[model samples]
Target: MILRIAMIGFGNVGQEFASMLLARREWLLKDRGLDAEVLAIYTKSRGALLSKRALDLGKCLELVRGGRNLSEYGPESTSLSPVELISKCNADVLIELSPLNIESGQPAIDHIVAGIENGMDVVTANKGPVAFAYKRLRNLARSKGIHFRFEGTVMDGTPIFNLVEKTLQGCEVLGLEGILNSTSNYVLTEMTSGKTVEQAVRAAQKGGFAEADPSLDLEGWDAAAKITALANVLMDADTTPKSVDRQGIGGIEAKDIERASSLNKKYKLIARAEAAGEGIRLSVRPEMIGPDSTFWSVDGTSSALTIRTDLMGDLTILETNPRVTQTAYAVFSDILSVLESIRAGTAH
Candidate 1:
């Protein structure tokens, strides 16, 4: 069967996926009987519609390279809202790479619901809706018998979710911890080297590790969102982002990092959610990990998740880069795996 695909939010990550589909067009068609193409793209910005073919890459890339949006490159194409596009598009799969709207999960939620309701499989990089309303969405997918993939959400391009679902099947996980936000990690590492939060944050921004408005990362909400999603997938519960107790690294002064360093410790943003005696207690913030700890070595924007379980104690550690890759192989890999599992009549 052909894997006809459409992408929402044509940003850095979405573009990455588009390039991947183009590069691997022939390979997927040949090897897996999947013919993937970016059938449609949606964005809130009206300027995003200024381009060609409604699916042109050269023009889209030119816009991105110029720090302009697709709308600036446009001439002719239907302009519709994201939800409407999902309902109307003739795509077998809907790929969601929109920015997280923490309040309502907005356009992401709207797009996901529309896609699945219209009998389309979905792959997402957005964490807001998943962290907030996973059970509802998954149940919706279950009822529709459509695939929903979100590997890039928890950790960029990471196998953490799949590792839990596949490698650690039936494993009773006791606790979860990770450097889930790359921007925070990079900033904290710089702070540990004597840079101020302001300074480190600037460096991260210059390095493209942070957004122009980086409050989500500075506030710990980003990692919190991912951790909450993990809790739902690893355990179970459609918990909201507000449900997690959050503490970002913003309050962390350079002195804190210095003091930790002097004490043979490193400051890292550690996100943890545990199956406590009463219930699940979740937290995300900067913590002082000892020099010898695994987290201490996780410098830069790379993220690592450590899963502690009843059977194997600390069983597996998974890592993923902070940035979306040049291609969408990571996301495609997730889709392929999910498809293979269904073909085998297995749970993923």
Candidate 2:
């Protein structure tokens, strides 16, 4: 079965995913017996290009790398929005790789909703929808009998969600705590080495670990969004980034880092969500952890999530120096999972 995919964003992760898909095309066909094709590529800057036939992935990559519009590839470009593309595109899966709008979860959420309503499976790396409207989107997907997977929303491609869903069955997740934001972790790690916050953040930006506007990472909103998504999925709680008690590392000075280091502790921007009295407690804050803690040794752009379960004790998953490819691999993983579900007649 050829899985026709309509990608709704042509940003960094989107381009990487497209490249990886093309690079692994033969392997995907010969080994997994899964024939996948990108049918359309849409971007806010370049407009939308749709082909009923399989799109030329190499050409798409070339056009994107050359800073040329996707519309130049022979398909008549439509000024249609992402929601319009999702509604009208003849594709099996709608891959939402757009930039996150933490405030409203827009455009990405709208795209996913339209995709599911229009009878297409949905996959996304955008954390906005899951952080702000998980239950609504999730229930809509179930009602429409489609798949909605966002494995890249959390720890990039570290398989946090997959671990909870595929493994750890019959065990209850009591709590989860870890470093979810790589940019913050990277900055903090650099700061511990005598670098100032601005200097460390500059390094992160230069390395593509931090965005141009680092407010999301420095202000703790990114980690909050991630933990909110985790809580909604694993704990069955409805929460948003605004609801999480967040404290960023932006205010931490060099002296603070020095103090923590002298005290034999490291400051990490930790995102924690756990079962509270009658509800789930979520927080993203910079906490000083000692050497004995699982997250204390997690340095650089690495991320670690420790899940405390009733039966399995504490299981910690660490992802070291995650880049755009890791996140793109998460989307690819979701695509394969969707294919497997289709083959097994369990896509819903």
Candidate 3:
């Protein structure tokens, strides 16, 4: 089978995914009997590319790496918007790798809707769509008889959603707690080693994981979004990030970390969603834990989640320090799963 792909964003994760796809081309064909090709790549400012035949992903990576616009690819480049590409590209899969719009899940949601409306399977690593509009988009996909999957919305490529959906059948997710934001967790981990919050944040920024304005991570909004996404998917909470009772590490001083260390404890930014009556309650806050805590050693860019399920008791999954490759793998694995569903005639 040949799967044509239309990607809505060509940022870091998207670039890494394309590189992986190129590297695994032969293996995919020989091992899985599948040929995956990128038909279109749409970017916000850099430009877009579309072609009936498979576009050269290697050249696309080269141009992006060389700091050149995709339009420099000559005639293959087009001036079409993302929606137009989704309508015209005739791709089998729509990969949404767009940056997170925490305020409101815009253009990403718009692009995904266009893909589903155009009879394409959808895969996204953006947490915004799941956190903001999971039910509606999911229903739309079901109505259109397309597959919709997002395994990268939380914990990079750890397969949180897939774990619950595919592996743990008949189990009910009662609540969840996790160290969701890499920046926040890394900053707190650095503080444990005697670095101040500001210095730790600077180090995170230099390390390329934290944004220039790290407020979203430091202020707990990132964790809020992750928890909201998790609850919306696993527990059917149907909520957004704004509904989180949030508190940031901004109020934490050096003395706080020092005090925690003195008492054999560490501060971690924890995001939690618990079943509350017919609704779910969500919160993100800085809390101190002792050596006995599961999150005690999850430092740097590492993340961990503990899922409370009725049948399986408590299950915790941990991912060590992750790079863009993990997130890229999330998209890749999701695409493969979509293809599997397609082959099995269970996509709907």
Candidate 4:
């Protein structure tokens, strides 16, 4: 089977996924009997590339890595927007790796809609769409009969959504609790060691774990989005990040960290979603936990989630100090799953 891919948002994660796709090309063909080709790559500022034939992902990665614009490729470059390119490019899968828009899920939702409407399977690492409009997009995909998968939106490559969908069959997810934001966790962990909040944030940025504008992570918007996404999909809690009662790590001081440590506790930004009446309540707050807590040992870029279910009681998943490659693997794994569904004639 040959899968043609069109990607919107070719940023750090996109570039890294492209590299992984290149490296695993042979493995995909030989093991999975799948031949995948990247046909279109769209970026907000960098430039866009679209082709009827497979675009040279190697050259694209090289150019972007060398700090050159994708337009340097010359002929294959196009001026079309992502949605326009989606209509033109004959792709089997659409990959969305756009940056998170905490305010509203914009162009990312638009991009995914275009893909599903164009009769393409959609995969995304962006949490905005799921957090804001999961039900709408999911209904659209179901009506259009296409696979919509988003495993990388939270917990890096860790299988949260897939675990429920594939393994925990018939289990009702009652609630969710997690340390979802790596940047916040890293910052708090540093602060426990006597570093100031500002110093910890700067260190996180330098380590490439936090965005240049770490406000999203520091202000709790990132965790809010992640928790909202989890609730929307797993528990059918139709909501957005705005609905989350949130507090960030910004309120933590050097003294606060010291207090927690003196009490034999560690501060972590926890995201929780639980049943409330007929709906769900979502919250992100910094809470100090002692060694007995599952999240106590989950420090420094590590993320952990606990799922409360009817049959399973409680289940937890963890990913430690994930980097870009894990996120790339999320995309890769989703693509292969799509291919399997396609082969089985069950892509819907």
Instruction: Give each model a TM-score.
Output: 0.90, 0.98, 0.98, 0.98
Q: Model 2: per-residue lDDT, tens digit, 151-176?
A: 99988878988898889888898898
What lDDT tens digits, residue by residue, belong to model 4 across residues 1-348? 789999998898899899898999999999998889999999888889988888889999888888888999869899998899999998989999998899998879999999999999999999999999999999999998899999999999799999999999999999999999999999888887888878988989899888889999999999999999999999999999999999998888988888888999888999999999988999999998999998889989999999999999999898998998888899999998898888887854
Off by over 4 Å in 3: none
Which ranges in model 4 have alpha carbons more than 4 Å from their true place? none
Q: Ranking by TM-score, best first?
A: 3, 4, 2, 1
lDDT of each: 0.76, 0.89, 0.93, 0.92
- List clashing residue pairs in candidate 2: none
Which ten residues in a row are the worst by lDDT in model 3?
Answer: 339-348
Ranking by lDDT: 3, 4, 2, 1
lDDT of 3 by residue, 1-348 (tens): 999999999999999999999999999999999999899999988889999999999899999999999999879899998999999999999999899999987789999999999999999999999999999999999998899999988988898999999999999999999999999999888887889988999999999999999999999999999999999989998889999999989998889999999999999999999977878999999999998998988999999999999999999999998888998999999999998998899964
Q: Is candidate 1 or candidate 2 better by lDDT?
A: 2
